[model samples]
Target chain A: MLPVRRSILGLMDRLMSFHRGSLWVGVVLVVIAPLSVALLLSMWRSPFPINEMISLLEDAESSTPGRFFDPTIRSWYRPLFHLTLWGFWNGSGSLLGGLHWFRYLEVGSVLVLLLLFVSYLRPRTGLQAAAALLAVAVMMGMPGFRDNLEIPVLMTLVGMPMALLVWMLLEREHRWWYTPLILALTMTAIGYKEQGLVIAPVVVGAWWMGSPGARRTTTAVVVLAVLAYLAMRFSTRGHWALFEQDVGFLFGELGEDEAAARFGERPWILYGYSALATIGNILFSEPSRGTFVITDHALSGETRPWEWISIVSSTLMTALIAWWGVAILRRDWSADAWSAESRLFVILVLALGASGALGFNYARDRLGGMAVPFYAAASYFAVLSVAERAGAASLKRRATVALVLVMLAGAWQLRAVGTLHDVRLRAASTHRTWITSPNWSRVTFAHRPRYLSIMQTMTPQGTDPARARRPTYPEWFLALIGGG
Target chain B: MPAGNTRILAWLIAMPALLCAVGLPLYESSDVAQPPAMADTFVEALDDRNVEHAYLFIRQGQDPNTLVRFRDDVRTGGREVQVSPLMLAVAGSDDNTAAMLLSFGARMDYPPNRYVVCLAREMGMDGFVDSQMSTASEVECPPPSGAEFPLLAYVD
Candidate 1:
């Protein structure tokens, strides 16, 4: 019995030592697994309009920078996103091909984010391998990633990695070119989405949390880039803050008047609920779940009991993770335990808060960039805590706990895999129904005809009409329409 | 890992959940006006040139004369109509009773394109119906005038 116990302890120590060897393998698995799932799911035809591609192509073809900022023509000033899309569309020569390129880009962004995270954790001891893998899995499994595959959402996703890269770069060497490069990246990120402005605050926050240096350098760079962004935005959109124009759509018929009324009736209370709900949606909701409902009446009878169970369980887990994050922040700040990981947690928390404040409703896609830091912090602390406890425990007890955690992680991975498979099945069915439908007049269950009408108006006549059609109508649609 | 730390962690987690639980119901139940799904359907149908389908979605019980006027106004218009679902939802108060002031796009003959669609519940009816239509700038149902039946609105 004594010999057996000694051997097991020796084996556990050996396994711990071997984690370095497994790091690359773990990184590859973490990056590839979700991307493979995404690729498989991509086989289904998208019902969403290729409005972004069409708009970019038109902008490029017309050679009009005016339209880029024109409030009536374009809703927002995202020049970098427009240019990137233009390049993709020009290169691909087809809308579908451009969309496929976006999927690849999205996967690549996820890889970059994972690589950055893994590189940060590689130097840390103990269960960081487990934590890194778990973080990646959690991030990939999020509904936000799935929702962000759509064109508009993909634009925001592009900005996320750019912002993260800027943050990473800022923490390291400060060459003369670094400021210009950081400024350029920051501006480009903003051009992708207004949410990119959150990067400025994140950089500033990170600098504040960072070791004391010429703070003025970081501050000046961020402020200058922001001013430049504002100048460009104002020049193009005729306003410094154009997000309000977009928010008007959320008010429905009442527009700003409804917002005013809601504000009058306890502004803080309304916003507070919005923030909490947004966080909840970010952490708890799965990609395979049905649309989020704000009102009690909107709850569907079809929602399974386990769906409710999953929500509650996820909520509890999220709360615990968040609590742990708060503890880490408190401990680290007080102890002056300033590391890249700690600074990242600070950035994510701020970003999450900023995201909640900017948007009125809970949209999983909007939370995509913010969620990365959250999962990272949660996983890091979880592993650290487990490692700490395991180090102090008996070998038999350590093995039992480690085995249980592995089993839980396995279950999570399997659940994510199962959800993706389910999504693929649904997407395939929806795609088939979308293509086979004869009457374009009536809205099918799988497709919204309203969007199709909008797309027809947006696409230039020179572009193939079939490409603009929903479910991207195959050649059969042209035949059915007598090549109209 | 100490008992004190565990208690502090518990409090930290509990506080947010507690606040959310207390605040969410209050926020949702607050009186904010929003248009019903039926209004969205009606406007969409009108946009699609399916006036009959639009009319079908309107809950019945309006002054016969008023109904005729609305039907004629929608059918004869060369003017474009765009229905924003968010606008419809935001314009009306809770309790299925609400009014929407719609803007009509310029036509060859018409200079101003503004109409009001008022929805209210009839006595003992389960659902709210489109009770009135007017070209008047201001129309209110279940308010100071109290001429229209009050019905519970659907919250989306």
Candidate 2:
């Protein structure tokens, strides 16, 4: 009969129904298309930093097939992008490869993305959840790396704070191992690339949101970071460090001095401004008079308009986050503040700010718009908007049915167009000539050897008409004729 | 109420069946009709630098002996060379291959990325140049993307 006991019972009922619901699975299945589109477009489009990456992936003498040493000091950004593509490939190998797998991950990313948002709907964008979802869904329908597409797989790198945020929101007691996982990830990011710097603010923000700004938990994390740095230093035994002379030579050799020479010298503030604006402009609109300016993603060649919408949605969501933070800082969170809902809102806001900052800063160069923090925050914004209003049996059936139909259509479009396109079917290529025939193409394209040799033999010839005109050796035909 | 709900449900079920039966079939023909030669992994078609491709293949999980066999079959005329299987991890894991890759090229003295310590550690740089025990070969980019970029196929 106690209020707390009654509340717990009410919560259990919803959780049970959610698990039992049939639509959740359907929802998962349908979002695949959008992701596929995102992947294909990302792949087929011109690669970024191509000259560098081309040598990185190809040159045998320059560390092709694998690197023995990090070639670039900026290893984080380069490796981070590779990992996102890797996740789509690894996670989807059991299923069909290509757009289909891409579609699945894309939809999964969005649905999960929305789930993050919904978890905070009542706390933050309660009234606007529907419009927000619709906007994000429509945005998701666009083809780009930023939307509900390739960004999800970088969950290990960018989503750390959001993951921690969700954990804190649930406030599940007895969480011991989360620290190690987070530390390993942070160290890996650092080890993996400088882009790992993004994890810091995100985790810090998570801490600020969950506890009252900074509990002993955050202090522990800070301590762990110092220890982690020491551990890395000890493990590598100071090998990673360059002498000051080397640093001077590396930069000095570039001939960047005023009296001697340089490649485009600018003040540090100006450099920071340019870099900051490049990130800021990608996310939102802010007029500036300085020589440093930024463009709409449309002008940047890194994104299309639809992708820009993700940046927009995320930016607006970021603005709301700013408002929430200001509210918390100013002690103006409604008189009924400090309640559960308010805490949840604060947690999400903190996560958004921290991740957004990283995407804007450390990863802005190598990843450009593809970084995790910004995209995840945008996804959170969109998802929260849609999920908050799913319950309630009082609505008319026809309207409900119509809504479902639209959602199904939207989900299909969102998944197919967005997720499927983003799929990266990375096939392993360890040089071999055993694959002389067309049968090897399946592996080359990262498809399962889905079509058997027979299927391949039957395939039509290309523009080179003589190829199809000739009788291709069939599997049995080959054995009989060649007598191998 | 039951009749209307059933009708809607029936329509929903029928639509997908229609797509799979017709739409999918139509889509399938356009793609499935393409030749198989177009689908092979990037490294499979090379005859030029057989050893290099073999190196790539063996590192990818193909046995080095088989690559060596493929080498003999191809008849490279040059003296047969035994490739150390341990060379694969020299680039760290395949995902961090750039580091190990740089190391693979280290014999020539490529300018090493100064941050190799932290970078190698981040990549979990396993120092087993030829140890059977190893870090998992993580192909970070999709294999197909690997095909198109850099070298579509490697030569011996």
Candidate 3:
């Protein structure tokens, strides 16, 4: 009877602690939402779909030629949550079930992050921090912390919880097992996608930023982890020469031969422009760069003016993020205490993580033009933070007012549901249009047969230099009719 | 509010008028903004040959990647076949209704088995990638060493 009573008391304490933590998170989630949503509205696509990258893993189960790449350690490194998605898919007899499972996980993870952020915020102006978060959200939309491609069910249930567990070490003393958990998470993130490389450095940096006494030891662990990762990567894939096939990177193969084989001996600038033409693919036009700018095959000509904009923006944006991060970290406010330093660190970390998009220079050709989202998010965060600090007026209120105005002006651009419906309605009309209209080129870009034939054949593989350039119906075709 | 600031602002304002005379045309043309287009025939000609260059022209919203998969259709006994007419489009303001047709002209010896189309319209972008499968025996190719069917004939 006494043991039971004691257990109940302990449970109550933990519950109360958890409740306190969650309240802060809830408020911040509200704060951050407006910003995230605004960003989403402006963005080419909702930046939250790291799920697509995760979906790659689940899809691999079915891809046969792809099977050649999968190995034992690779399987082990995959997040348990991503792995679980396959199971859920099998159980529910539909991939959508697994997808929903992930959505719920994402929603739950947001809540958990809110709790943690709030807990961190608590040492400061408690409710004010919540208001700040709300301001942040309203200003930025949900920052791009989550991947659009990762399998969410296992990710939420296993991956994120594990991440949070490691996060606890940032605030409290490290449990002996925490190292393994962090290593495990990093490895899993990598297995989920190659972009996981971006994560490893941030974490190692985070670990080093902690307590002075532990800094050296943590740094050593980070170094060893990185070394071990390299060793594994080399052992498995290093022996195999990096294939110079102009496959996915429309950025052009930075292959030894091609780099040297340039006619002008400088393809970088040219590739930069070509990458810009491919740039809009990341935002407005397609769901992903995956299918359209299929591979290195997508790019053309020299870097264009707009592409230069992409590069400059991405650079300034990255610099801004790095600045915020350095400023925050330098202040010794590593954890979420109320100190200006702590606030700086929190915003810095958020900015850096969000700015560091999972999809880096997507194709070799496109650094500036192709890499827009990361910078956009970063820029959005910087603007939001500046706005919040600038005055007493709530950013949320302003952004909401702005959003309504924008929607009123261009309701068509803001809604996702409309996009989905447009596709359905136009698809049939397009078919009819194509059947009825003999001149294929006369039809809209959607009706082109070249696009149709490839739909089932294979997804986009970017341009290969060796392959002769394929025929493309020009963009001027738009002007062929009225309103183009 | 400062006197120096006001003078600097006046100078800045004067500079813009000088620039606007030059900037107006560019600004006006840009407002009719669209990604620069390739000569219509260059894109169209490639589509006719079912050549590799044709595939490179796929626009936004179109699946230029899936348009010509190399490893796809190995099972169900299809020989290595190259499908043609890479469809890549830009989903316009009403992405569904505004959805424009753009293609990379790599002539496919075979017709498409399926397509996923996104339409541009007032509401938004929506469409289906209609998937269909056809017999593999119809294609003629020397079988790839590892399999019964020929590997996909890469248009390139």
Calculate the i-RMS of every candidate, to one decimal place.
16.3, 14.6, 16.7
Sort by DockQ, best first.
3, 2, 1
Q: In candidate 1, which residue ranges exceed 4 Å CA deviation?
A: A1-66, A70-75, A91-103, A123-126, A173-176, A211-215, A231-273, A284-313, A361-364, A393-411, A418-484, B1-156
TM-score ranking of the models: 1, 2, 3
Superposed model 2: Cα runs more than 4 Å off: A1-15, A18-171, A211-219, A226-266, A285-332, A335-484, B1-156
Q: Assess each prediction's global lDDT (C-alpha) against the native.
A: 0.46, 0.35, 0.34
Candidate 1 CAPRI assessment class: incorrect
- lDDT of candidate 2 over A401-483, digit per residue (tens): 43553443334233233232233211011111112222223323234333333223222211112211112324442222121
Residues A87-143, model 3: lDDT tens digits: 555656654454445455554544454344435445122324323333222211111
**Model 3 Cα lDDT, one tens digit per residue, B1-156:** 233432332233223222323443444355436543343442342323322223224432334334432222322143333432232121112122111222232222223422212111111223311111112234443322332321122222
lDDT of 2 by residue, B36-67 (tens): 33313323322332333433443455532222
> Which regions of candidate 3 fall more than 4 Å away from where they truly are?
A1-25, A30-86, A91-131, A134-168, A212-225, A238-484, B1-156
What's the iRMSD of model 3? 16.7
